[model samples]
Structures are given as structure tokens and as C-alpha cells.
Target chain A: MALRFALMIDPLAADQTAPDLATTFTAVDPAAPALTVGELSTQRGDGIFESIGVVGGHPQEVEAHLERLVHSARLCDLPEPNVAQWRAAVAIAASECGEGEGVVKLILSRGVEHGPTPTAWATAATAADFSLARTEGIRVVTLDRGYAIDAPARAPWLLLGAKTLSYAVNMAALREAHRRDADDAVFLSSDGFVLEAPTASLILQRGDTFITPAPNGAILHGTTQLSLFEHLAARGFETAYETIPVDELRRADAAWLVSSVRLAAPIRQLDGADLTVDAEFTASLNDYLLSPRD
Target chain B: MALRFALMIDPLAADQTAPDLATTFTAVDPAAPALTVGELSTQRGDGIFESIGVVGGHPQEVEAHLERLVHSARLCDLPEPNVAQWRAAVAIAASECGEGEGVVKLILSRGVEHGPTPTAWATAATAADFSLARTEGIRVVTLDRGYAIDAPARAPWLLLGAKTLSYAVNMAALREAHRRDADDAVFLSSDGFVLEAPTASLILQRGDTFITPAPNGAILHGTTQLSLFEHLAARGFETAYETIPVDELRRADAAWLVSSVRLAAPIRQLDGADLTVDAEFTASLNDYLLSPRD
Candidate 1:
């Protein structure tokens, strides 16, 4: 027998709307027949997923996000979800959702298949109350632990580049950060290089040049980060992608964690070090990020 | 409602009859109700699991296997399981199963909440007919992927040693290998050092010594490879845990991959070179590994 339960979406609809959260798609559509929750979990670690904010009811960076999804599928050898099917799912989900700047989480996972078979499944959902924009600056902690820098690279067998659902570790890291009474943990290499945060992109400023890790396999090829890179270049901000050691991070003029949801969050403190970087950096980036691109 | 499934026994029963798999603690009976699957998957990836061969109603490495299950839990920060409960589950599953040396996997993932909030959870189970072990050898394609070699040491904030259910990357790497028409892929660093095999232990033979990557946070601490090291040591063979560069691997006498299921599979060919190392080294290791430790 299939399991059934009421999805409490009513409470979420009654909220101030935020423009960043555009409804691109949703997995739990009202009109479509629902699937058993167990079935959803049993499908192999399905591929990876991303939660991007939509602007003006439009999925931000749709093409680039889809490209990453396709790349992740190829890397994991998962079957590519049909583009039309995905577009329809997103439309259906967006049509029924209520309220504000909600989240658009795109999950490209494995389809229902057992054994050594190629299966790729993609699902999108609009999450309520998952605003990346926060009122207060984040208290960040730095932790040392990793064999190598898990940055993104152009490698054929790179999983860090693909957003697969084996997110137990990622979620656990967040929980670990919470245990320490911090917002998030920064993953540093054994050699003490500032890598990406758990789910967000790393953006730091060295002089007038903004720097992020290169698109290596050690890190996820974030869509927002990529978008920001292009926008920064267009706005005449000096930008470069290079390896940044942990010590250099301490000397950074400013730092912020970027992601689709929390477009760019100011880094107030690093491991309790008082960061006196320009708070205006965040404001400027946010202004540009939220403004509609012609 | 709880999902009900029939339990079978035979090979599991045979292993249980030995009393070796029984918990040594007199205070707490080895056989007791443990934790649920969801808790284990969420918490510390703690659990005792075995992919064994059940030939003619007997399970392979029943004692050593069970002992390893306990060891894995301890190493990964998990609690001791009710061995009796595990044995009972295994026995029931084995009895009703078909004939032949099918795979039997026992997992002690998470356990019952021990009163106050525990730092970790525990669980265990067994399964038959796992496919990871049957392949003669894996054809590994290398990826210049940079993993934090000291990810654990650098990130005390992250649980590097835990074997949580977040195995998407590991599984994804296998799929990548399959896509490349290779059996498996060895994750490489930007510096060209062989970091690990997604699901198995890294083994490189230089002259007479068999060297594996150290048990750093970068890779899973493999139980089978550790057993082989002891076996190799007993025979005056030099087995060391050290960092191996990918360039050095290309010139090594041979290379092999070890895991719970694959045991020890020689790298017959890497890229395109035929190492032909399996005929002797893999067979010798297999012979020693398959032999009774006592």
C-alpha cells in the first residue's frame, strides 16, 4: 500500500513575498498523482541537486543550471531527464505554489532502477520559508580537515563537480556547525587553503580583484558564483580564479559566501576574528544580483 | 504502519552457531532490538554490514566478517550492536534465500536512542547477492580530481571518518567508470597522486612492498585492505600506508584494488597498459585472504 499524508502548504502561502525566489518547478504538485515517499527514497542516491532562487517568478540562470545538471548526469552516468518533461514539471509546480520569494530546488537523481542500470531522475520543488537573505551577518568558523582541496575541475570522473544526493556528509557538516553555535563551517584543506563552504560559494576580495576558486573538481561549479563572475567582469570589478590559502583569507579585505538562495552574505567574523571588511561589498553585490538583467 | 517482510535463515544461522559473532558483554545480551534505518542513515554512518558468499547454507568469513562489523562501528564512532539480533536477522534471511554463494550483507547502522542525546547512533543488517564482489577485476580510469588529502585533519568540523549514507559520490564514480567502459575509476589529485578508488582501498606494488594510501580523512578506512596488510606482514611482505603519486603508480610493478566485496582485484590494465599483475599478486593475496586467520 502507498503511504499518504497531508502536505501543509497553507501556512507557507501567507507570507511577505521575496523576489529572489522564483517558482521554476516543484516535485509535490497538487493535481498530479503523488508517489509513495518510500519510492522516492529507494531510488538510488539519485543524482545531485541545487536550490536556486527565482527572480520575478523566473528561474534564475536556467540555462546554466540545466547545463550543470546535464554535466552532473554525464559524470555520474545517469540518464538525462527529458528537457520538455522538466520544463513542464517546473511550470506545473510554479502554477500551484503560493507566495513570496520561495526556493526552487532542482534534484537530478537516479530513476527507479535497481542494480547496475543507468537511471537519471530529475525533480524540482518550490520550498517555502527558505530565504537565503538574512537580517544579521553570519558568524563563521573555520575548521581544518580534508585530504585535498575538493574544488571543481574539468575532470571526467569528478563527483564534487556534480551535485549528487549523497548529502549525508554535507548535511552533517551543517549540523556540526550548528552544534558549535555557528551558522556554517568553512572547509579548509589539510594544507590550510580556504575552500568552499558546505553549500555556498566562496567569494573573497584581494585588493580590488574579487577571487573565487577555479572551476576544478574539488568544488561544485556553482551557478550563482559563475553568474557573479560574469557580472563582476561586466561591472569593471577585477576578478580572478586562483587557489587561496587559509592564511591569505585572514588578510582578505572582505569575504562573503555566495549561493542561489543567499545571493551573497557578508562575512562578519572568521573563527571569531573581527572582520572589518567593507559591508558595502555585500550591498553592492546584492543590488546587482537582485536587479533584473536585461 | 511498520513494513513487514519475512525473515530467512541458513548461512546466517551457520555463522551464529559458532558463538563467535555473539557479543562478548555479559551485561547486555548480544541479541536485542537495535535502531531503525532512517536514524542510522541520518546520524553517524555507523553500522556493521557484510557482503558475503553463502555457499551450501554457509556464509564466508562469518567470524572475521562479524568481528569486522564491530570494528567498523567502533572506528566510525558507532555503538556496539546486539549481535544476537543481527544473527537472528541474518539467519532468517539466509534460510529462505536461494542456494549458491550469494551475497549476504549485515549492517549495524544506528541503534536505539540510549536515553540522553547520544553523540552517535548505531544500526546493523545483512544482505545477500551483492554485485560489487563478483567482478573479477575493475578497469579503472583515472580522474585528475583534487581531494583534500587531509580533509579530516583539516576539518575537525566535518566527520571524515563516518560512513554515513551519503555515498552518492562513491556510487557516481562507479557509474562514471561504467560510462567510460572501465570497471572503476581511481580519483586523482591535481598533482597526479592517486588518492583513492571510490569504493575500494588504493594498492600500489613497488618491488616487493604493497603500499596503500594512508587512512587519512580523504578516503574511507577500508577493513579488507587492513586485513590484507596483516596477512602480508605475517609473510614478511612489506605493507605500508603512504602517499602515492599517480606518476609513480604508472611505473609501479603493479597495482591492485581491495574492498570488502572485491577482496583484492589486480589492476590488469590501467589507461591502456596491461599490467598483468593479477595472475600472481591478486591470486596470492586472495589465497592468503581467503584462508582462515587462525
Candidate 2:
């Protein structure tokens, strides 16, 4: 599929009348490059971003994504992004990719190294297939995130809770999992606390209760997980947030990795060891996650 | 000064006659943009980079920077960069800057998300002045890097030694330091061992011995520090690599932050506490650091 892109050099100044900023162009090519080599986003990964799932041309959990984007920008000390501009951009991109499931990304960066303006853009592209993993479950490996559970509290400079573009280490952890013949990875703190996954949140079943790690500044609060917990609470399921030990993962009745695009993928095996999985529960949880909502 | 940039889509295939790839472009304007929104470098920070100082249009310590670039790529599992192509590009950029001190950066990224090739570029711009810091010295604050000293050794997936473009945390640390009324920062491990500065190497004077933190996989092996150690050793100054405790920094006679561009800037104070600095000694060290070398 040909990827569609739109660039707003100064997204803050974007108004309804600006065609390139308001309307998604199919083939309306324009002059001037979208980015320069000196952009902080290119040179230093100094930016905040969000990837929203588009199902049948409708964005899923956009308000949560936007809230997280603002929180991330605050962590990086970047200027506040114009949420109306972002909403408009997302609408254009989603409309352009009509009737199909796609990925819409909102990127707000600290512009050029020497320039004061921030660079923002929206992109629409075909989503990758996670159908097999979502149905058949996935195998995972445990990797160390090289931090103690309290690391973030002591060191805010780490930007642990922010969804920034400096994801090289996260990508490396995923590649290491792939090399070890696993489909995904769950990170463990150096002090033996179970952290979140590289790009997802961890959820496990303990008896009839659904438990996930607390948002202790070491992990990005999972938007999908929040939605799932609300749905589960409405259906008479007990939900809790606490620090989980790595060993407890093996003892859980069932485990899953939850995210924006993939929803909830059950864990069939971890570190080459088989784990319990309830397929019926997995399907029901995915149903609740993917169901239409504002 | 207007920054000069040259893009090489596939630098590995660069040859003498490929003007756009081998020879730096002056004004060969293109209709299409150089970077797309889907670039991994912009989106995920999946790239490696090097900044070399050019004096009188000659790139300083090119060999050391290139060696580090290769080492960084290996850590990231990125495709090997073509050194010959990089050399040609750097030469052209430095030449274009013409007879003045400048900064030339070599950036190699994982290309666009949909493309298989890597994107490489060389940018030349006037260097920022460090004359004040070099002469009057700088005050520094110590911040925790939120990692144990042994974290990197046990977790290679952290990409600790690789100088990747995912530098958001580094940039944040600098900003934090600036907010605290300091000019720079020195990061300490969670276990209380001094690691390195946000963008430079930490060198402390313990009597006559020059002590620096060993490359324990948690810090980038600094090129400027290595050159300074060699220069000091030749001049009958003792040097050693060992893990320096944070307390030692407070009691040290002198300290300096060393980097390729900034060279050597003496530390006037640490965490608002004054320290001894011999101006004559600092000037001599700067002279040795900037002296002609291959």
C-alpha cells in the first residue's frame, strides 16, 4: 500500500482554511521538504508521539491518546500542542484511509535544532496483521529494562512514563526477543519487579481478579488496559493495580499483552516455558477492547 | 550561517561520479522531500550518529569518530556503514564550510518504515562557541542515571555503549542542569558511581593521577577523553580508568568535562560547592587537546 503523509510545518498556526493543513492530500504534492536534517526529532529523538488505531475510518480512543500526548510533551518540556489541530489532522488522515483499518500517527517534535517552532504531522498507513497472534496467542521472553522499580521517581530525566520517540532500546529488546524465538517481550526491572512490555501493558488473571502493574512512573499507562478494566468492572470482575513479581507471572492463571493496535494477545509461553491461557476469556476481553467507543 | 546538507539515500553504493551521493550538493534542488514521515529515525529513533569538529575546514579526529560509529551500529544490529562513502561525504561538507571552525554530523538512519535501505546525510554548520566555559569554567550538577553499575553488563539490549540518536534523556538531563543554575551535568549510577556527563566525559584529578570512569558498558567510550589521556600520559601525567564514587568528586582537586567539540571545560563547582581549578593547567590541557593529530 502507498503510505499517505501530511506535514504541518507550524501546526500551531494551522487554521481551517489551510488546504494542506486541513485536507488530506491524495496526490496534491507541494513544494518544500517536510523536515530538515537539523530537526531535533531527526537528530536527537526529542519529540512526543501517539499511534491511534483506525477501524473502518473511525479512530479508537483518540481522547486518551491526546491526553497521553500532552502528558508526554510536558515530560519533555516541549510546547503544548494544539489539540484542535491534531484532531483535525487525525480526521483528515482517517477519512483518507476510508473503509479500511489503518494506523494514524500524530507526531509533535521540537522542530529544528536552531529553529523555535515545533514540527507536527499526521500519517496514514496500512496496519500490520496481528490476527494470528491475537487468536493463537504469543510466546514471550523476559528482558531486563535495566532499572529499579523506583528508578523513575528518582530520575525523571529518564522519561520513563512518556511515549517519546527515543525508542531504540525498546526496539532492541523486541529484536532480542525475536532472536530468542519469542513473539514478544515483557521487561523486568533490575530489582526483580515485573514491568510492562516494550510496546504494551501486561495483564494477568489471579483467581477471578484482573491485576496489572500500577502506574508508578516506570511505565506508560496503557489506554487499552484502562478501557479493559472499566469494561471488566462493569461485568462483575474484580480489578486491581499493584507491583507484580516476575515469578508471579508463571503462577498466574492467564496472562496477556494489551496495546492500542493489537488489543489483547494472550501469552501461550514465556521464556520457552508453557503458560496457562483461557481462549474463551481471551476472546471476550478482545471483544470488549475492540468494541466501538468514543 | 545557513546550514548545508547533503542526502545519500544509499550511501553504501556511493561512487565518485554519483554527484548527489558522493559529491555534496550546493543547490541541486529536488521536488520531492528528502525525509518522509515514516522514517524510523524520526519515528523510533532507530539510528546512529557522529558529530566531528572541523577546524580550518579539516575534520578533527575523523578516524576515532568513524570507529565509534561502526561500534554503535554493531550494538544496534544496523547494517554496516560504508566508511569510504562517509569519508567522501565528510570531506565535501567540511570543504564547503570553507576555512572556519564548523560542526559536521554524519547521520545514518534505518530509512523509511516501508523502505529497506538506510538514509545517510552530512550536515555542516558553524560551531557553537565554548570560549567562556573553557576560560572561566562551568558549574555542574550530579544527577542519577537510574541504572545500576552492572545493569549494562547484564543487559546488552539497553544499547548502553551505542551512541544512538535516542538522546531524549540526555537532552532532558542538560535542561534539568540548566534549570538548577548549572552549565552541565554528570550522571551517576543508581549505585552511586559516577558514570559520565550528558554529552561529555568526566575527568577528575586525584592528586597527580587523572581518574575517569571505566567503560563499564553504561557510558559511551569518549573519543576526546581517550585523546586527552594519551596526551597527558605523554607529558608525564598519570592516568587511570576506574569507577569513581560520587563522594570522590566532591573532594577532588579539579574536574573537567571533555568532548570533541567543547574540547575541555573545567568544572568550577559541583552541586553548588566550589572546587579548585588551575587556569594555567586548564589552558595547557586545551592546547594539547586541540593540537594537530591524525
Candidate 3:
């Protein structure tokens, strides 16, 4: 229960008297709460975040997560985050977690209402074990995402590419999946293109090629998925980025949901029909995904 | 700057020792902040909210706002809010604002990440003046909302009709409008059907009929629009709800963005082209809208 939390407020703001990262991180109490109601993130969900896995006090894919967070901030029109501040905060949080394994959340918000600058924070907590999901795989159902594949190009205001904090709909989709006695959900575009899972990126294999939906401004640029593709390419495995049809999932030889925390979880069932899952291949992908990148 | 704020935690939660309405209301410091970091609202945008106009310490259209809140809660799968508690809190917050007009925001969130019950609060601040928007009117640009008009029926996970706190996209749309030198935005569905504005409902007059986009599950139910329709009916004006095309807006007699606080602000221009305005009719409608409903 000894979770680590640290907040970094705008130093230039006259009313903010909180200590800087060095002292604050060192003195953070495990039981103390770290947010205020006036924050734009809490009030309007106007922010961006990254959830990086922490192993043995080191953040996994720190650079990749930071790059994605910055990209997300740009999409939301947020001020550029202080990368050094985020790095320091994450290191402190991860170290304080003193870990076998944990989850480090990097949150950069649009600051308080009408206040100048942004609010940044890092929190470290025990990571949820996904051993069963990795080995036994997951059952998923398809749900309409209510938008066409070209939505991102047609509407930038949609903020489709950003990994924003406005994830209520995503969470609701997962809840709906659970309500239907399923483990997860695969969202399909209104025009019948496979999009992604509620919390993870979709990966499907037809033969030797590991395929995923192209970024196309419709999906978040998945760091974990990108890392896996790089590893697969180096090992002479074919990979692709394309507009995947929902029917392609049914015809797929294997499918998986890939993310930072869960790594690669194969699809055991699509809808109610059992799909052929390559357990050995899935185990190999997890090994590549979980391995620390230089 | 003396704004009134109060927090309400579930009484059944043993850890929450905060006093109920009476003592908490009397002791509230206007300057004190009312939220903490653990709240799911700030973290995940998992909540619903209502903003009611308080005129001379009396909340306008209380029943309508509360009823809408209930509907929104049902959509988000949140527990039934304690209506009596909300009423008491609103009364206290309103009373604390003296005889001046103010804005009262009622927020009900999914509570803390690990906590059991929901978190609810009401905050009252001086109302923002919209005299210019009311008299001079506003210029609007149409933006694609990235979903088809019938999307809500096909996808409940979209939370289309619910006024949840996950309004980053809405806020972004407004910002995009401002960037284009427009005062507001009227969101169009991907299929080019007129929907509604980010924060307000659209009402346009065609011939003798007051036509607004029907609540086809793609837009939030507008309390102000509903109240106006009732008042219009009483005054012998014809009203109708139907699927509105963007082209129809160009041919309309007059259009307005109606909301609780702003009341009714006429649209003077659509995408830079000046539109006809019935100032006399708009003023008359505002009179009806501002009048207390039984």
C-alpha cells in the first residue's frame, strides 16, 4: 500500500508554495493525495498522460512514452511539458516504489482554471499482474466506435490521435464488454474498419505478416506496438500497417491486444467463436515486448 | 471573489467524517478549494455535471437540470444521486451568494480510484455577463463531430446524449472556432447533418415553424431549448423537431444557441456570411426563457 505520488506546480505562479521536485519527491508521504479540484484536467479532462511499466526502479520505454505524451499535448494544444521535470519525477516515483514491479503514471494537465502554466505529476503503484491474460488469452467482442476511419482527417477537433485523459467512453466500452460476459472489446469504425481495443492496440497476423491498423490519425501511436514491430522486423518477421477490415479479424490466424502494461495478450475468442491462438508465438512476442529497450 | 463551495461524501463511508448539509454549509470558506487528487473525475473524467443559473439566490429550472442529471447518470452507469442532498446543497450554495445572480455547478463523479461511493459537490460563483452575446449575437462555424447522426443508437459507449465531464473534444471545438475568428461552433455529423453546439443547443426559425434538431440520440437533451419550445407553444408560435441539414441553416429565418446561463444568443453569421436576425423576436424569446417556470 506504499504508493508514491509527487506533484509539480507552475513555479512562476505566485500562489503556489509547494516545494520543487527534489524536496517534494523525497518527502512525499504514501498516504497523501496529490490533486486539487480547480485543475482543468479534473474539471474538463483537458490533459494528456502516459502509463509506463516500472521494473526494478527503472521506467520502461521512458523516451517513447515521453515522445507520445508530447505529441498528445500538441494535439490537445497544451503547453510543451518540461521533459526534465517529468524524467526527475518519474525516477523519484519509481525509486520510491522500490520495486519488484510497478506502474508509473505521468500526467500533464492544462493546469488550474484561469491559471498560467501546466500541472505535472507522477504516481507509482503496484502493477496489476497479467499472467493469466498472457497465457490463457482474452475473449473480446466487437463494438461500433461511432466514427468513420477517415474521421481524424475530417475533424482535428475530435482529438483522435491523442492519448488524452477523456477516456470515459473507452471505460464504458470495457464495462459494456464485461456486462456481456466478455473480457475485452474491439472497437470497429462506423464504416466497418477494425480500430482498436478500449485500452490497447490491436495486432493481427494473417500469415508471416503481423498487421495493425495504420496510424491514419484515427488511433493513438502505440509505443508498445511500435516496439514489437521493431523487434519483429529485426528478427526477419514481416509486419505491416494497413486499414484492417473487421472480417479480417475473423479470418486472422492470430490476434492480440498490445500495450505497455499488459504487453501482448492473444485473442482466445472473437465474439463467441473460438479463434486459433498461437500460444508459443504469443509467449515469444511477450518476451520481446517485456525485454528492456536500450 | 467570495464564491461558495461545498463537498458531499457518502454518509455510509466510515472514513468520511465531514458533517452533513447544516454544519458544512455554515462553515464553508469561500476561498477554500473543494477537491483532492484521488477523485476519479480529475483522473479519468468519469462523472456527470450540471450548470444552473442562480438568479437572486433562486436556481432557475431546477427540476429540468436535476432530471437531466438523472438521465446523464443512468447513461454513465453511476449510482442514483441523492436528489434531496443535491437540493439542500444547491440551496445552501445559492443562499451563500446573497441576493446577487450567480452560476451554480453541480458535479457528481465516480469518486476516488479506490473509494466505494460517489463524490458530489456544488459550487456557486458570480454569473458571467452575456449581454453582448445576447444583443449583438454570435458568429458560428460548422465543424464535423466525426460521427453519423444515428451513431448514438448504434453505440451507447459513445455517451452521445450524456453531459459527462469528458468534454475535451467539445472544448477543443470551441477553441478551434475562436482560432478561426468565430465566436462559436455548430457541430455537424459526419454525414453533413446539423447536430448541436459544444455547450448550447441550436434553435432556428423556418417560416412560421421553430425548428430544432430532433433528439435523435446524437445530441444532449437541451433543457433551455425544451423550456423555450414550451413557452413558444403558449405564445401561439409553431414548433417542430426534425433532422436538420446544414443547408437548411443557411435558409433559416433566424438561429440561436440556447443554454441555461447564456439563455438565448442569436446567430448573426454562419461561417462568415451574415444571416438574418429577428432581434425583436430574439428579445421576446429571452423574456420567455428568463421567466420563472412553474
TM-scores, each model vs. reference: 0.66, 0.94, 0.93
lDDT of 3: 0.81
Q: For model 1, give the RMSD to the true fold.
A: 9.2
**Candidate 2: where is the Cα deviation over 4 Å?**
A7-9, A14-33, B7-9, B12-33
**Models ranked on lDDT:** 2, 3, 1
Give the per-residue lDDT digits (tens) of candidate 1, residues A8-77.
1111222234332223223332222232111212222445555556555555676676677777777766
lDDT of 1 by residue, B1-294 (tens): 111122212222233346653232111111321222122232222233454434444555555555655655554445554455555555544443354333455544333223212212111123333333323555678865444454456454344454444556566667767777888778875566677777677788887898998766656666677778888788888988888877778888878787654567777678766665556556777766545332
DockQ-based CAPRI category assigned to the predicted complex of candidate 2:
medium
Model 1 iRMS: 10.1
Superposition TM-score, candidate 3 onto the true structure: 0.93
Q: What is the TM-score of chain B in candidate 1?
A: 0.66
Q: Report per-candidate TM-score of chain A alone.
A: 0.78, 0.92, 0.92
- Every candidate's DockQ is 0.19, 0.57, 0.55
Task: Please give the lDDT score at residue B232 for candidate 3.
Answer: 85
* lDDT for model 2: 0.83
Q: Which 10-residue window of candidate 2 chain B scores lowest in summed lDDT?
A: B23-32
Candidate 2 residue pairs in backbone clash? none
